[model samples]
Target chain A: MSSSEMTSPEETPLLEVRELSISFGGLQALNQVSFAVEEGEIFGLIGPNGAGKTTLFNCVSGLIQATSGVIHYEGQPLDGLPIHARSLVGIARTFQNLNLFHGLTVLENLMVPVEVRQRRGFIADAFRATRSRFGESQAREEAGAILHLLHLGDLRDVMAGELPVGLQRRVELGRAVAQRPRLLLLDEPASGLDGRETAELGALLPRIARQLSVTIVLVDHDMALVMRVCDRICALDFGQVIAMGTPAEVRNDPTVMSAYLGASGAVQVAQR
Target chain B: MRFDRQLLVRAAMVIGAFDVLYLLADHVGANYRRLMTLSAVDGLLVLSLVVLTGFVGQISFVQAELNGFGGLLAGAMIGRLHWSFWVALPLAVVASVAVGIVVGVPALRLRGLILGVVTIALALAFDAWVFSLDTFKAQFIDRPSLLGWDLSDDRATFAFCLAVLAGCAWMVANLQRSKTGRMLASIRDAEVAARTSGVDVTRAKLLAFGISAGLAGLAGVLLDLTIGTADKQSFTLLISLNIAAVVILMGPNRVASAFAGGIFLRWGSEILDKVGVGGKYLNVVLGVGLIVQLIAAPEGVVGQFSHIRAAAGRSLRRRVAAT
Candidate 1:
């Protein structure tokens, strides 16, 4: 896994979001939000409620099409690709609420993406035919590698729903990574976790980015996680880019402070 | 490829058990033998529901519609087109896939009870229009004596139907363990989540629907071959509802439960008829049994057995460890 893509940021950014905007009915959910994520970087999107952070993730992942503007992945336009097509093209995402299959074990959950990555037709797979069985051993090897990578080796055969929420979140992350995505979109992965779990997640993001050689764009409300892990952070407010820079620079910006802690209670944010 | 040893063993067991039962059936009458054949046909129908509602979680009340279409088409090919039954078999399955796709298209947009209601409507339309067509009906239905075996005899018909049902059952069992099986299971658990995981939800659901319908079609073709008729009236919405009830009673994931429900109900009805109760009144038995199953064991008889088997395996492992 190479981190060399981070050094050549001058080349076409791994993901370039240009003036993306969308509206649900009359309310403009996102308005001209723009940012570029270089490869092997843990980029964070932080904002208060209704700030269009999730909307932006949805647009980039192709869950919903943007009303205007464009998203370029590895210098290629992702305009016409469907949701699963985007995943096939090395884009993967997790939901705000965890979406792991309750019936399947953690190993099988990871195998879903491994099977998807193999791109074998279901008809052949139904009969256990040539092309389907060809990658069976390799897929298991890859799934084992991922289970180890995600620290889920212990819970390999445990049903995904039986695991703790923190572990389920980890399994969901492992599942997305199993797709071999170049750009991983994580939506509010820390919503239900306690301090310890969130800290562990904060620790995992950078390791995932560096080790897997994937660019990360996470939408989160946890400021400590945002400030601690992200190489650079983008702040959104009322569907627009409010701040875009290093964590220190963005933290010091007055507009971001007022947007989060309000103008009067600004200094209290440092304690939070 | 290595065959699943357990499945092969189970298939042999089912066949051996039925042969033993055939000895007792001979003392009773030819009616018992005929019911044995019906049991296998019913198993195919129940397996159809297993795929549609069980794996895909798509509620389809139009399974009988698809089944009737396949049966009649196969019959027509054998009778009207003067084609061999073996040749018409694949054509029937292909035609059922087309019908399944049509029924499944609405499923891409609809769900649950609404989908069921839509299928019910489609079922009536099919009986009144599609199945009523001269093209789908054949007056000259004949037994498929493909390998020079007379399939018309009671024992032979039961054996042949049982073999066909077992073959389909084996194929379906293999499917549920493969990647496509996981794909369908994932869709059942979480459709949106599956899409984000790079599973084309539409394709997975439709594929399930197609395979399920094909099974139903295959069963229907076998039914026409056995009984020498493919009357559309026999495939009413009532039969589909009965199948749905059995699907709920037997548990979805357990493939054997489909056959179990079929054989139990077929014999149950036969016994009921001999004991001065109308066999049609078994719907009362089904309803009561369903109520009991829902309250005591929602996973149904098969799921209950699965739990017991797992527990027994664990205890056996512990015993070996102690030694």
Candidate 2:
């Protein structure tokens, strides 16, 4: 069931998650967390390990099912749709772990989702979908556009695995952008990068969101990158939403501070 | 990133080089020609495996069984129904593609070793079911004809197989550059990443299976045409094992390793038999070669070539600068 307060937002939130919960066996990963990401906004989902950040991502992307909740995208419910369907609806995401095919070239990596987006829907499959000659040309054009945007047009021929860690993340990002998504969910885009790489990511990310008109839901542990890129932040502790506000508000909140450093530890750390 | 004039020229140059090679090979000795034909057939099968295993990252051990479906269908249509080879061949391909979809639906749900086990079972089942039926054996003993021409002759069969192999290669090469190829590659690398990136894992897997199975079916039709009969004994489980081995042996960049593996199989057998040992010894050698290739050249021979070329390019550039 959706929250009654979901109607409060007038701009028609790009992604609306209400009371979403998920669990593996008996261990609950996400617990009744409600939030809405506005269109073209950089939204952050932050938490300690096992705080259900990735789990929530999995739910919205349709990789994992929500045990109880409603997730709406563009006013349509995204509860039972498979992962690819969510992708077709302009919802794209990356992984917490690097998920690039080492064997393929960087260019090949970017072409994948663009091809999917170029595919005609289920009706096309049933009625000689491939017979439509427009599909192939469109796919090629879209794929080329994505690769060019990522500045990976040069590395297109190079094997994806051989690239450095920073480049791989960009490749992953490029792959997502290729899908032409309205909402992009990035799971720890700055996980293994150094300060410079992270800063480069910081500069590149906003341009991507602005140019592509994509709303971002980034799940990260890096406060610096998150604070820099994210317009708003949602803090989770133990599967529950403990704080949600602007970066400054969430940064100074007592619950968020305590959640990061224990109840008494926050004061001690502050004093030091 | 820009598709410049130089890139187009390079692509044309590569295609032109192949044409020259193709012309040169046309005048070679019969034995070499036969090996080439076998290589072509092998390449077709290997190309299928590359799409399924290498590109899609689904380890399928049942490609031989899928080929068997093509060979058997061709035999049944030609011998029993008196159908033309052209008609029978496409019929076989369609049937194989259907089987691929059916099997893929179940197999795709299971990943890693589980998917491997399930597909292997399908391959084993194809072998056992065909060999066990006397009616199938008796009724299906016939030559596969193409365009009303009985294609039992070796020379004609070689030409036909070579043409089909080239066509198959072209299709695969185009796909490798296409968006579908990228999607499968991404899915193979990381399904979660691909899925979140808006790629549908299941559909991509299914398409990969279909492409691979279609190629296998095409190869099977060519095989039956060469042998003049469709015997269940011809497409052994070992063929599946060998194809998988070939993929591993060739590594990733060498999509053409399928052809190389075929040539190796043809030459390696004769060399082994000429040494006074029987043809059975070839499998042992193949097993060893497969193991060595997996260990020594897991990137396959093509990967090694690229590596050497890169190193040579670097050295040459340095020398030129110094001069």
On lDDT, the candidate that comes out on top is 1
**Tens-digit lDDT track for model 2 on B24-134?**
456676667666677777778888888888777788889888887887788777777888777888999988888888879875679889988888888888888854565
lDDT string for model 2 (A5-93, tens) is 22354578888888888878999888889989888889988877788898888788887788898999998898778777788878888
User: What's the distance in Å from true for residue A231, model 1?
Assistant: 0.7
Regions of candidate 2 where Cα sits further than 4 Å from its true position: A1-9, A120-156, A262-272, B1-39, B138-153, B276-278, B309-323
TM-score for chain A, candidates 1 onward in order: 0.91, 0.86
Model 2, position B282, has a per-residue lDDT of 78
Model 1 spans > 4 angstroms off: A1-10, A262-268, B1-28, B137-140, B274-277, B316-323
CA-RMSD of model 1:
3.6
Note the residue pairs that clash in candidate 1: none
TM-score of candidate 1 to 2 decimals:
0.93
How would you class the docking of model 2? acceptable
DockQ of each: 0.65, 0.42
